[model samples]
Every structure is written in C-alpha cells, then in structure tokens.
Target: MLFSFIQSHDQNHIALRSNDHEITYGALLRQIDDYCARLTDVDVLGLALDNTIEWLLWDLAALKTETVCVPIPPFFTRQQIDHTIARAGITHMLSPAGLQATGQSASPTIPRGTAKITFTSGTTGTPKGVCLPASAMENVAHSIHTMLGNDFAGTHVCVLPLAILLENVAGVYSGLVAGCTIVLPQLGDFDANYSSLHHHLKQNAATSAIMVPELMRALLLQVIKQGPLPDLKFLAIGGSRVDPHLIKQARNLGLPVYEGYGLSECASVVSMNVPGHDRIGTTGSLLPHVQASITDGEIVIHHPGFLGYLGETAPGHHLTGDLGHMDEDGFVHVTGRCKNVLITSMGRNISPEWPESVLLAQPGIYQTIVYGDGDPHLSALIVPTGPHADVSACIASANETLPDYARIKHFRIVAPFTVENECLTGTGRPRRKNILQQYLSPLAVKETPMNFYDQLVAQTAIARAELYRVPQLVDGLQGRISRPTYIAYLTEAYHHVKHTVPFLMAMGSRLPDEKRWLHKAIIEYLDEEEGHEEWILNDIAAAGGDKDAARKAAPNLETQVMVAYNYDYITRKNPVGFLGMVFMLESTSTQIASMGADAVMNGLDLPKSAFTYLFSHGSLDIEHMKFFEKTVNQITDPADQAAIIEVATNTFRLFANLFGAIPHVSEVRDVA
Candidate 1:
C-alpha cells in the first residue's frame, strides 16, 4: 500500500534528501527493489542506521518484502542492543558500516502478520519489542497524510531518529504517502545544535517536521534567537506531554506548532492537532485510522492497529494505560498515566503530570517529577533552568493554579534526567521508578529517610570515585611526583583558596530567612578560611619556588572555571549549596591531604615548612568535618539538601578537571 502511494506519485519528484544527495521516486523505487531482491532469503532484518536516504530505502524494501524489520535505536545500551538482536531472532543486521550476518538464523515466534518490530525503552533498562503489521503502519501513515492535506506535502525534514516509531510512521511514511520530499539529516548534526538544524530546515524549505517536546523547546529558543523559519507549515510535537503554554508561545511567535499523542502499541500516532482543526490543551482529534474511548478512566483503543508483543498473544483491544477523555468537540485530553496516578493518604487521586505540567509552565522550572503516593502532601524533584533560577517563586506561582492536595509542598533542586543516567526514557519522559530509586526512597512515597549529611555522602560516592581516579591524584597517592608538578599544584590551589572567605561571606549574606541557623557556621568558615591562601604561598616559598610569582600567577582555566562556578553557585543558586564545596574540600583534605603531603615531601625531600598548608588542613579539617556534618544534619529542607547534593556532584567533577589540568610529572619531564 505504501509502495503504491510512492509509485503513483510523479516519478521525477524528489523523494528523499540527505546532506547533498537527492533521490527521486524513480531512483528510490529502483534502490528499494534492489534491496528487496537481496533480502529474499533473510527472515528477519535488523536496521541500525542514522537518519539517511539509505535508511528509508532499506525500510521501504523490508516493508515491500514483508520481512520482519527491527529498527534499532542508536541510544540503546550495549546490553539492550545484544538483547534486541537475540530477542528478535535477527538473521541480518544493517548498520552504517554495511549489512552483516548476526550468525543467528532461528525464526522467532512473533505474532502472525508482524512486518516490523520497534523496541520501546520504557521505564526500565530493557527495551520491549512492539510487533507491528505493514497494513497497520500504512493505515496510520495514510490517515496522517489525509488529515494534514496537501499543505503539508512539501519538504519534510526528519528532526528525530528514524528508529523511533513516531518519526518512522508518522513523519517519514506519512510524508512519503503525501508525496512530500523527505529530508534525512544525520540525527546528531542537529540534535544538540538547533541553530544548524533550523538552518538546514530553512535551506531545504522544510514545511513540516516531527519533534518531541524537548526538541521543540530547543528549536523554539533557536527561532527566538535567530528568526522563525518562514517556510515551516506544520511542526508536530509529541513523544511526551507538552506544556500547552509552550505550544501557545510558539504559535504567538508565528511558528506553526501542534501537539499530538501516540504510543508504540498504536503504530505511533493515534491522535494529533492539525492547522485548521486546532486545540491547545488537548492531544487533538483522533486520526481517521483509529477509534478511542474512555473505559474505566483509561483510554482504550479498539483495533488500534496493534498486532501484539513479540511472544504474546494479540489482545482484542489495546488498553492504552493512559487516562484521558474525549470532549464534546472530539478532542482527546490526556490526564496522565493510569498507573502513575498518586493516591494520597486522604484517598484523593491525583495525576502527577497535572501539577508537573503546571510547574513546567513556570519560568525557572525546567523539569519536574511530583510524588507523594501515600503521603499527606506532594513533593517534587525539580531541575531548575539555571543557577540563577528562583525556583521558590516558580513553585509558589505554579501552586496558585493547582488544587491544594496536588500542590507541591516540598521540592528538591536536582540535575536534569538524561538517557545516560537511565533516569529518563529516550523520549524525554522520566522513568519514575528509576528516578525514585535514585532520588527518593524505594517506596516512592516520600523523600529518603536518611539524614541530609548521610544522603550527601551516599549520593556523591560515584563522583568521589571519579575525582579519585584523576591521574594526578592517583599518581600523587602512589608517590609519583616531581618538584615542578608540586609547585604547579600549589599555584592553582593558591588562586582558588583566596576566594574562600568571599564565597563564605556571600553565602552567609544570601541565606534565606528559614536558613538563618546556618549563618553562624558560615561565619566560622570565613574565619578559618581567611588566610588559607597565604599558607599556600608560604608552602611555595619553603619548597624553593618563587612565592611572589606564585601569589601573582593567574589560575589555570580549570581552576578559574571552578572558582567562577562556586561564586555563581553561591550567589545565583541556593546559598546552602556552597556547603557542598566545603564538604568536598574539607572531607578530601582529611582523607588524602596529609598522606599526599608526606608522599611528596619524602619523595622530593622537601622541608616540613613546605607541607604546612597540607599538614594543617589534613588535621584541621577532621574537626571541621565533625562540625560540618553536625551542621548539615540540621538541614531538613528538601530544597537545601538537593542543592548541596547537586553542587557537591558538580564540585567533584570540576575539581577532577582542575587536578587533571595540573602539569603531570611525565609531562614536565618530557618538556624538560
């Protein structure tokens, strides 16, 4: 059916574009025929390539031959890749390098009529294969093309990975069905560099593109920075719930933006918003190919074009697991996931996405996940826009729009969830289980019961390992040293230490009213840190290095960035976060400062005066850590704890860079 649409189009019309290469319908069809001929003996084909002309050709060829095509997402971990190969019983694999045999020829028992298997990396580490039929996929594509009409039948740029079902069926297949030229840019070329991506789109005169909310946000920002793409007629945003305000913002700026909803089980798109029949808050009207109704507050799709899982029997109907409803105008309004709905202790059920979307609409709040399944009130883990974000005010403003029970009572400022951390799905949805395991306790009802100090210690263990792994720190611990390298370390240390008192003073002055108790500790820190830079200069002088030169030397780029980060972190972010730097410095001093001093001194035969700063800090920080731990234990606010943890994590990373930038013993020897 898809091939017929392609074949019926003008044979000379450009069908695919990647970089500078273009393939007309005639050439595309010929290439697909050649690919189909080669796949005659193959039972299952694993397609693993970036967005390119060849990827589309191979995909269409697989569809033509009725081969069980498995599109492997590049972002899948090695374990996931291996699992997919074995689970799909893949016989041949096609990657950027070339097609190769996987050595496995066993035919897996998938659902009958399955033409393609797309893996969805859900809330877990492992990805599950969703078996789809060619007819079902074609139906969805045809419906999308029909709904979008001829206005969208122009250049359609592929903004997302072709491996994703949403981009595959709704974007590429639908564009082909509409006889639109498909532009296949390398996913990485524009994934992070939105400016280049928008430029590519403008250069191609792209009229339509499919994007997730995250990508849409980036592109919108880019458009604001540069200017709107004049040729763009349709931009469909999906993969996760989008803030309606974002859609409104895009339209107000004259960028055509629409929100849609779909899942892997439905062959990608079940409903969408188009140009004339547009609605802001809803997921838009249902597509012509699928029928949806609310059953038991869960969206149920009848004959949803789904075949079944790889090994499971096909169900009569698909229970979408998404809770939503169709309004009088036939638009679908998705509330949230049925399983993700939180039942408070008072028995009031609330969807976390409700307050979460509201929170996200605020200026400073970037990403948030709300939780309080069996607790009295809701809490959230929020990733602020930047260090200067006033998250308190943002949360307060978001609360004004939500019911009291669903209002966020407590929130922790944390790092952004990423696919690398396995805390977020590839589609930008938070893996609630993984996030809760990493941030909250196992039960997911409340914050971890551990004290703030203990939690900090537990959370930063991996970062500490990374810090310890720096070559300089490792070699220094093992007694590998040079006199010049030691002096270089002292030079950088002097530069950063000079700012210690100022950082403390700034932190003390910026403490919020509720954290007034921390002011005394900050004052004590200021007094202890006042002359620490002079000690490093004295150590430099005793070590036979020019103390005056060391005192006036500029800090290395890494050291300068670290100092700037701390200052910015103290002034812009939560002042309490500065304790993270103290925790890192003092705790590290107590652990390794004395031992490293002894190793360097004995190895280089330096005088005891040369070790004054290290020796004093080694012993002095022990009592300081005791005081620090006691003070941090008194902090019960979730936001404060989150700030400290985030800063400590960043401090460990930046400090590692600082140590890494120091002149290594081997480098100095080579230089000499």
Candidate 2:
C-alpha cells in the first residue's frame, strides 16, 4: 500500500503530466512495471534526470523493485556528483545521457530498511545522505492526504527540482495519494522566471505547487505587476526562512502562500500550514505521525532516523540543528539554526537569522545576510528588492528593533543569490561558506590603516549625487524654475540650518568620554556655524521677498520632520549619529553650493547681495569637509564608524525628502 493510488484510484484517471502528454494511472503503472523489470537486479540506483514523468517512473519502479534510490541534484558540482556516486556505491545511473550500469556491481553497505538516501542542501559543507525508509516517506504523504482531505485533489505542478525532497514526497507522492494529477516540467526550462513558472501552472491548470522563498518573492513581484494568482488550493513555501511580511504580502496579492518547515531526515515535511489552520508567522503545527520536542533550545525529532549515511551507522534520535519552540496553540516557530550562531570578538554570541529576519521585514531589502564572527561588530551584504529601493532607510528602520550589539554596522548591495550562480542551495538557503569566500574579501571592513574618509566618500558618491539629480532641484539649479520654487527650497533649508547650533550643542553635551575629542570638534564647528540662519534671511530680503515674513513663517512639514529626526538621533539614539547630519549638509554644500550660486544668480538676474550666503558657504564648506573627513577618520571604534555611516545614509535620504517637497515651475523659462 506504499503507492495506494495504483490500486485504489480509477484506472482511467489522469495521474501525471509532462512534455505536453498525460499519463493515466493505469498507463503510469504499466510503465513503472516495465521499468521495474529492467531494474530488478540493481541494488542501488542514482537518479539524475530532470523533473519529468520519467523521473516519477524511475522512482516508482525502484520502490516497487526494492532498489535503493539516491537523487542527484543537477546543481551539484562534478566533484559533488563524483562523491555521491562513490559514497552511495551507485551501481546504476539514470540521467539525460540515459541509464548505464557501472562496472562496480558490489552494492555499498547502507543501514537496514533504507529505501531512499536524501542529501541535505550542501550549503555549508559536503552534504550527507540521510537514509529514509519507504514506509516513513509514505507515512508522511498519507498524513498530508488525510489532513488536506478531498479539497486539495487538483493538479499539482512540480516547481522545485525533482531531486528536492519536498517535491518528491509532498508534490509527487502526496498528490498521487490524494488522486490529483501531477504536472512535471524540465528543470532548465523553468529557470528563475516566476512569470513563466506561473504560466506553466496555469497552462496545466495546476492547483497546488511547492516553492522556495526566493521563488515566492519573484512570484509576488510578478503578481504585483500583473494581477491576482489563479485559484490555487495550496502554495507551500519552505526550504528556508519565510519572511512574515513576505507571506502577508503574498496573501494580500492572493498568492495562497502557506509557509512550512521540514528537513530531509524528517522525510521532507514535519509541519505545514493548511487552509483552515494557518498562522501568518509560525511555520505550522506538527504532522499527526511526527513527534518534535525541543531539548536545550534545539529541535529533536522522535521520528525514525536516517537508515544511515552510506557506509556508516545510523545515528539514534534525529537532532535537527535548528532552534525553535512550539507556540501556545501548538504551532511551531523556528528562530534560527543553532550551528549558525555567531560568536563576536567581543565575546557575545549572536544569531544572524534574528537580525536578518528584521531586515527582510522591510519591503525594500529583498535578500540579506549578517556576519561578524570574530569581529567587533556585525555587517551585512544585501540585495535590494528593486532599482529605486531605498536600502539605507530600510536598514535604519530595521535597526530600530535590534539591540546595539546585534545591529548591522555596515552593508553593501550585492547580486542576489541563485542556484544558477551556485550561491544558494536547491532549497533557498544560502551557501554560507561559498558566499563568505566570494563576497567577504570586499564586503568585510579592512583593519589596515588607510584614508577611510576617501573610502566613505567614494562608496557613497553615486547615491549622494543621485539626490542632487532630483528633477525639481536640477531645474532650480539650472535657473529654469520659478522664483517661488527657489524661495521654497531656501525656506526649508533655513529651517534646518537654524537648528544647526542647537543640534551641535546637544551632540557635544551627550558625547561619551572616549569620544570627547569629537565633542571638541563639535565645539569648533559651533563657532563657525552660529548665525548662519541670519544669512538666509538676508538673501530672502535681497531677492525682493519679505525677510520678516520668511523669518516669522513656520517651517514646512518636510523640514520639520528632518529636524525632528536629527534631534531624536542625538538625544534618544547615539549622539555620534549627529555627525551624519553634518556630513549631509557640508558634503552636499561643497559639491553643489558654488556652482549652484552662479547658476541661480545668472538664472534669476539676482544682485550680488542676494548671493552672499550661497557663494560664501560654497567656498567655506570645502575646507569644512576636509576637516570633517579628518576628524571622522580619527575615530577608530568600529561601532562609531557604523553609527556614522548609518546616520549619514539616513540623513541623505531625509535631506532628499526635504528637497522633494518643494514645488517647481510648470514652464521651462530661463530666469535671466
């Protein structure tokens, strides 16, 4: 009764779809019987075929013939393929090249009752095969069939590669047991195109599918652009951490995303969310046949252990290296992997998944990883969700919920991980060791003494210049905008500028003793920056606008928010973050002021008296930026550097928002 569908289901019912062809249950069984006859003598077989009906045939034939089977993922490197071949002592191989038997017919010794040897994702190290009993896998599939009941008996598409445990058990076995047609596709044809995947699903009229988190993200994005998803009965997401926000967004878009949790040792799925008993954040309640308990903060399953690694003894209780706890409602919640805990150089142990989850909570950051093992503080490598994504603001927002030690100190945008690039497992989990080897060299903060000022400037230049490229500011600087628009820009600038001295005073007063030298620098800045607001008033008067009226007017909403955030930064958050505000103003002034002043004067036909503030600051901030750079470089604390970079990034975004609020002219008229 392992494959009960063969005898229980109607012989004429369609059971499998592949290559534009359908196979009925009767036809599929006849094919499996023929295949099984050929494989009767083979003790162990390696399946390297794509996700196709042929793969199902191979698997079913092996199960019927009592031939041990090991699935070889196409993403595996040649070395990995060779290792699996030798380790499993595979006597026969089935791949695109067709089935061939090796000369070595001596079957390798595996644990008793071993039917399937499923490999882990192989992200961190060489993957170990987890031997599983056919009965156990069938037990899981039958449990799913019972829990889901008759409502889920629609066509199921194989989205993940057939080598994946989830698809093999949940997609193929359970779908058949539930009397649903299983649609199989070539792995290469699918690629990472979620639209194409969705199209394939619709074409086949598939009602259920299995997806990793990355695919879910792509599908969600496509749905956002297109429309709601098809009426899917179930869309299971697992193989990695599923962001709660991502799940919520997917559900809102009618994607029918249901998060789940499992491992290869647990026969693909131990817990999953179904229609009537779903929770947004939690993975799901445990399956009826599986027993999961937490001992010393690590999840241990009382289910059958792997038959054994090829040529090794089976370990007793399955200790899933993952950390989690059961909710009051019996729902399971996974925090992170126990093995992934990062021990900082400061002697504090932290888990990257905790903060990585917070970062993923923001819509702009599509994928991210945090690393600080043996370092003073943590840093991240991120992939943005879209071209116009504000990464800095997202990090700042995420940092609000994290502790100081666990907060991301620095981050850089990187290419998103994909199976094609070998940066991720067939499942969605990142290949942490490979990723560290590839990106760590450049992403890691260098301990060597160098000009960090230039480093900061060079790193932030493109994004900073983008702020000046805002359409309204660009036109204003070109003297092609109305005088009222320019007046509004100056109006907001005046409000922020007026608070400069007060902000500095607050920063200096709150400085920690270790950074008292920075306080001294702030005092010096205070002397030079005091009374700068009066100069804005003078410019307003010379431009033929009422200076008193501008002075008495309340600051615009954008300017008020910017100033309020700065005050909050210095008082409630780290006072050192105030330097970010300084960098925002001075660096921008040095770059734009002198050129802008000339452009404004010629564009407006303004008198020399009206331009004093712009022209003087244009020259003055050049020296000020040099001083600021030197002072920033002098601070050697990694935490301090992080604070400065974080604040500076946020300040630039706020400054852009402030500029964006002002109105621009409708017509392109030359000022002069």
Candidate 3:
C-alpha cells in the first residue's frame, strides 16, 4: 500500500525535506530500493541515526523488504543502547557514520512476521522491546490518514524523534500514506530553540504535526510569544496525559490543537481528537482499526495485529494498564495508571492523574507527580513554571475542583523532571517509582543504627532542601532583604509563633495516660514558647514599626494554613505529631536564626534590640535541640514515629510557604 502510494503519486513531487536537501518521490523510491538491495542479506537492521532523510529512507526500506528494523533512541544511555543491540539480535547497525556488523547474527526468537521492534522506556529497569508487524503499523497510519481526510495532505512536520513509535507510524508513515510532503528537521533544530522551530514550521508551510505534551507546551509557548503559524492546521499531542486547559489555551489562540492516546503495544495511535470529531477533555474517539472496552476498569484493546513482546507469546487482547472508561460519545477518558494508583490508609483508591491533570492545567505548575500510598493523604512534588510562580494559589485553585480525598493536601516544590534526571521517561511520562525514590524515599535505616530523630531528619532531607530554596529565606539569610521585607517576615512569624504555646498545651491536654512522658516535654516547650510572640512585638517596635498594628494584623494565607494544619493535626488526627512541628521549628532556629539575625543586623544597621526574638530564639533552641533529640528518640510506636515524620515534613513545606509568601525586596520596589 505504501509503495503504491509512492509510485502512483506525482513522481517529481517532493516527498521528504531535510535542512537543504529534498527528495522527490522518484528519488525517494530509488533510495529505498538501494537500501533494500543492501539489506537483502541482513535479517535484522538497527537504524541509529538522527531525524534526517536517511533515517526515514532506511525505515521505509526495512518495511519494504520485510526486515525487522530497530530504531535506537539517541537519548538512551550506553548501557541501554547495548542492551537493545543484544536483545534485538541485530545483524547490521546503521548510524550516521555508516552501516557495520554488530558481530551478532543470531537472531532472537521474536514473533513471526515482526517487521519492526520498538522499545519502550518503561518506568523501571531496562527498556522493553515490543514486536510489531508491518500490517499493524500500516493499519494505524491508514486509520489516521482516513480520519484526518485530505486536509492534512499538504505537509507534515516531524517534531518528536523518529525513534519514538508515535512519530514513526503516525507522523512519518501516515504522511507518506496520505501523499503529503514529510519534513524531517534535525531534532536539535527545534529542541534547542522553540523560536527557530516555529520559524522552520512556518517556512515549510507545515499543515500537520505530531508531538508529545512536553514539546507541545514548548511550541504553544512559542506560538503565544511569537505569532501563530497560520499554515499549521492540525497538531496532535500525546505520549502523556495532557492537561485539558492547555488544549483550550492553544485553541483559543487559534492554534489547531488536539489530544490523543496510544501505546506502542497497540502500534501508535488508538484514539485522537481530530478536526470535526474533536472533544476537549477526552482522548477522542477510537480509530476504526481498533475496538476498546473497559475490562475490570482497564482499557483493553482488541487489536489483533499486536505480536506481543520480544519473546512472549501473543495474548488474546492487550490489557492497557491504564484505568479509564469510554464515554457515551465513544471518547475515552483516561483516569490514571493502574499500577500507579494510590490506595490511602482510609481505603480510598485515588488515581494521581485525576488530580495531576487539574494541577497541570493551572498556570504556575509545569510538571507534578501525586503520591500517597498507604498514607492518610495525597501529596505532590511540583515543578513550578518559574522561580517566582505563585504555585500555592495554583494548588489551591485546583483543589477547589477536586473532592476532599483527591485534593493535594501537601506539596513540595522541586526541580523539573527531565530525561537527564532519569525521573521522567523519554516520552514525557513521569517515572512514578523513580520520582518517588529520588525525592520522597526514606533512608534505609536498617543498614545503620538510626534513632527516630535521625530517621525523621533523613526522611525529610529533600523537603528541607526545597525549603531552603524559597527566595525570601535565601534573601533573609544572605541579608539582602529590605526593611519592609524583614518586617513582613517578623509579622508572619509573630502570628505562627504566638500559637506555639497554645499548640503545646493542646497536645499535652489531648495525650493519653500512656504518653505522659511526651506530655512532660510539651510542658517544657510551653514554658519556652510562652513569651516568644511578645518578643516579636517588641522587635517590631524596635525595628521602627507599629507593634500594635503588627499584633492586630491577621496572618497571611500561607501562615494561616500552616497554623490551621497543626491545630487540626493535634486536635483531630495525631496529638503526638505536634512534636514534629517542635523539632522543625527549634532545630531550624538553632541552625539559622542567630546566623541570619547577625547578617540582617549587620546589613540593615539595625540595633541588636531589633533582633530580640531571633537572637533569643536562636540561643534558646540550642538546649531545646538536645532535649528534642532525646525525647523523640524515646518514641517507640511506629505510628507515632510516622506521625512525627509526616508532621515534620509538612511543617517544613508549610514554613517554606510562609517564608515564600513574604514579598522580596525587589518585589516591593516593583510594587512601589
């Protein structure tokens, strides 16, 4: 079918376009013929080239000659590349340099009629090879072409790497089958500069393209900053759960955008939102080649062409581990991954993707992974849009639309997940287990003797690191904050510190008789914390601010939320968790309070009296640390220890928010 499309088309028409090179249908057919002649003796061919004309030519040649083609992803590590080579049993390897023998002619026992072996970068361990026959690949391409109709026959730009199965089947083969001019730009050309990519697409008069959500985000941002590319018509985004709001934003800007769903197991595209048959939230209607049904809450595909894994026998149907349901309109609404589902301690099953989609749709969040398995509530690790994004507001807004159990109760701002970090898969899907291990895993305490205190510290190291990233804390510690900023910090501090004694008294009152030892420590904490808020008020006066107004002012939303969380935890959930707040506050004061006070006094030329609270708290917490360590180490109940750790982690994150809510010196100037 592909050959007939190529041969019957206008022979002089341009079929493939790279940087400056162009291949007409006649020339492209000759190149494929030459490659096929060369691969006659090769049973398995490994194409490891960039997204250039040569890569497409060799891939087509493999399809024509019935040779199993294994396209190696360039982002793969050396070990992964070697594993693919050995696992696929390649006879010949074709790279930019040239074709050479892999020195292994013993072909692996893949399923019969396997024409292409596409490897998926799974969440854990090595990549897995999915054997796909030419018929399956062609069926997907034909279905896409038929669904899209003649509107996409102008030009199709390849954005994602050709090695990705989505780009290989949907982008390249579909373009060929539709007799559209296929543009193959070097992956670096677009990846390095989205501005240049927009220009490249416009220059080529690109009418259609396929990309993952990550690339779509970049392109959308570029299109927003620059003008829209009027020539580009259809943009299909997949490879991960796309935030529906992102699609709406793109379309609102007059950029034709659509969302799709597929897996390599079923050959690229299973369902997609196209021009006339589009739906915003769902992943469009199913393609004609495949039929989907929800079996035990899993999206099972009755795709007969799937030849199964590299060595496994073909199953009756592909059980897509994704959890979703088909709507009355036949659109698929994917909720989340089955294996990635979080079953809370309260026996509620929560899919992270359900809340994740909401969070990602918000303005400030760039990427997020929701986690809380066997725990009381869900928490997220968010990658903000930029250094100064109002992520708290974003989470709060998203939570408004979610149910109580599905809301993100706690979140820690972290760096973006990327291919370089190994926390994100190549196709823009978060490696859930890898991300949890990297940012949220507790230390292996069994490897060494660690008390509860040590375990709490080790477990919350990441959250602590994230806390230190708050701009206000960073500036305050560096003595770069202005007088108003310092006053603001003091004001918020007074509001939360004023509750310290009250919180201690509440915890002491709520404790059972068996926890009298903990109650004793709470008494000591109350004694130390009783007059701390008064010290803050006096410092406000010493700093040339109104002490009366400072005391009358309400806490900001961040501080209020933190205080409320503690109050609820002490009164309702776990009274022992109050110790976690104590540990965070005192330990932090001991470490940085005095140092930061000295820096601020020296930098702002404020009198020592102005830092009364900070200096006194710093001095008082040194002894409190010794006491805290001893008391917490005495905790033996696993539930109590877990409560303490959870509270400590949340306190650090909340305190970070409190500090973050304070306006920076430059921000104040900007407002002025």
- Estimate, for each residue in 400-515, the C-alpha lDDT of model 3 and write its tens digit: 67899988777877778987888877667888877878887574221224457767775765566567667777556646568888899889989999899889888988998899
Cα displacement (angstroms), candidate 2, residue 552, comes to: 35
Whole-structure CA lDDT of model 2:
0.78
State, as a TM-score between 0 and 1, how close model 3 is to the true structure.
Answer: 0.66
Backbone clash count, each prediction separately: 0, 1, 0
Q: How far is candidate 1 from the true structure (C-alpha RMSD, Å)?
A: 14.9
In candidate 2, where is summed lDDT lowest over 10 consecutive residues? 663-672
As a whole number from 0 to 100, the lDDT of residue 509 in candidate 2 is 91
State how far residue 208 of model 2 sits from its true place (Å).
1.3
Scored by lDDT, model 3 comes in at 0.83
Superposed by TM-score, candidate 2 places the C-alpha of residue 642 at a distance from the truth, in angstroms, of 21
TM-scores vs. true structure, each candidate: 0.66, 0.66, 0.66
lDDT (tens digit, per residue) of candidate 2 on 524-567: 89999999989888888888887888888888787898899989
lDDT of each: 0.83, 0.78, 0.83
Per-residue lDDT of candidate 1, residues 192-304 (tens digit): 43557667777788889998776776676555444447788999988777767667657754579888999888899999999899899999999997887899889999987
Runs with alpha carbons beyond 4 Å of true place in candidate 1: 191-196, 441-672
Report per-prediction Cα RMSD to one decimal: 14.9, 12.6, 12.6
Clashing pairs in 2: 131-307
